[model samples]
Target: MVPKVPIDLPGTRYHKARVAADALRQQLTQIIEERRIALRNGRASAEQDLLSFLLSNGSDEEERGLTDDEIKDNIILLLYAGHDTSSSTLTSLFKFLAENPHCYDQVLREQLKVASSKEEGELLEWKDLQRMKYTWRVVQETLRLLPPAQGGFRKAIKDFTYSGFTIPKGWKAYWTVNATHFNSKYFINPKKFDPSRFEGAGPAPYTFVPFGGGLRICPGNEFARVEILVFLHNVLKNFRWNLVDPDEKIIIDPMPLPLKGLPIKLIPHSK
Candidate 1:
């Protein structure tokens, strides 16, 4: 979508985006106020979480703390950047695994090994996470096939030439992850969901960037990885789920999502 086009005029998609942003800011403002009150009354532990740390400036009085509005803005930024990407990836991962029973079995086996190593009611730790090699490959392949971020925009720092085309300096450029992900030069039978491709050295640098590449790569990449892996480990250990719509098509409304929302039926694992 040509979002940069001067289409913010009423009734346009740009206008709609602006309206949605305003609504979100208002909601975050209210939440920030509630958090501030909780911190003052000891209702919520200060430095307990990101919001608290932001408010307290890492418990340092000398360091300047973020203003209430700044804290709210950051909360909005993190939610906007991190929330949907991880959720969509998780949904797609499960959907694909359910459709490919072999992959699901492999994932389940790997997770079982980790689960058995831990005592009953024991939580996953860093060591257990390190053992999730196959599951991580599945995550990698899922990201390759269905990247949560489709493309990103970057302003050209200098004029450049590629494929016999010259791009002028300061011109904005868009890089599509799908093009690289599916390129034959970088992958063999790119459409195939073979997590084995991730076993060795993996794809060339900058070629397999689901979180992006280089200096501007996402800062939350590690956080997202830990969150997804931990969630997957627990979910697989405790429950089995099946996609209600095996053939549900993914549609990208800016980001990829199932056409009808990825509905699933979950059954708790029997002892």
Candidate 2:
């Protein structure tokens, strides 16, 4: 059965959503404006220049590339999912690394090897992403333990049988990544966070979907991966990190938000 809203009004819902979205847009625009002013005189990198030029100075065809509504929706969607998911995932990854010294040591060693093998002497390149397989495994394990989009709801289009239970048509199903991930039947050593589980035998595409599956899978997963790895690479290279408290509890929510903010201490890497 679909969960019924206590107070439902179709008109009121859109109106409320619009008002909230508008307020958020205003706040974000203000923050962007502030950053623009701050970086106005600072040495702008090529990437920054490219981003500013592309968003601000549009060509004639580019202007028509996306409608005002499309642009607004995409930008808003990016802000909503892109910011928090990546941050929360990164935080979880950090916490995992801090708690598991073997994992940390392995990552550090791999990063150092990567650093040494950079022939281009560039910070990060598209090709370098392919070489970070172990790092990718680490991320996969992190998602298994702390998936950013923790839970979601789906409505059955027709009657379905799941686990021998008949789900009636139009029933709303509440599902969670955490609930399925730690199942012993689905994973080996379900409680242990081991990146190697993904090495030879990868999870079924849809079974371990952090970014959903099929066509609805996040379009930005590749983009997200690159960004995450880039940020992690720099942080790992420049800093020696340790958790303030190793035994702290990890609390998961529907949003995959941490109950306790990951407090890590980073000292400059002194060799």
lDDT of each: 0.85, 0.75
Candidate 2: lDDT over CA atoms? 0.75
Candidate 1 at residue 155, lDDT? 88
Clash total of candidate 1: 0
Clashes of each: 0, 0
Worst 10 residues of 1 by lDDT: 56-65
**RMSD (Å) of each candidate, 1 decimal:** 3.4, 6.6
Question: Top model by lDDT, which number?
Answer: 1
* Model 1 TM-score, 2 decimals: 0.85
- Kindly list the per-residue Cα lDDT of model 2 for residues 1-271, writing each as its tens digit: 7855545455776567777898977775674455445546564432564234433443223644444344455668878788888888898899888888898888878887788887655777887778888888999999888888876778888999999999999988877786668877778788899998898878755668788765567787888898889888878877877888776777665355545576789978795
Model 1 scores a C-alpha lDDT of: 0.85
Q: What is candidate 1's lDDT per residue for 120-142, written digit by digit as tens?
A: 88888888888999999999999
Error at 34, model 1, angstroms: 6.6
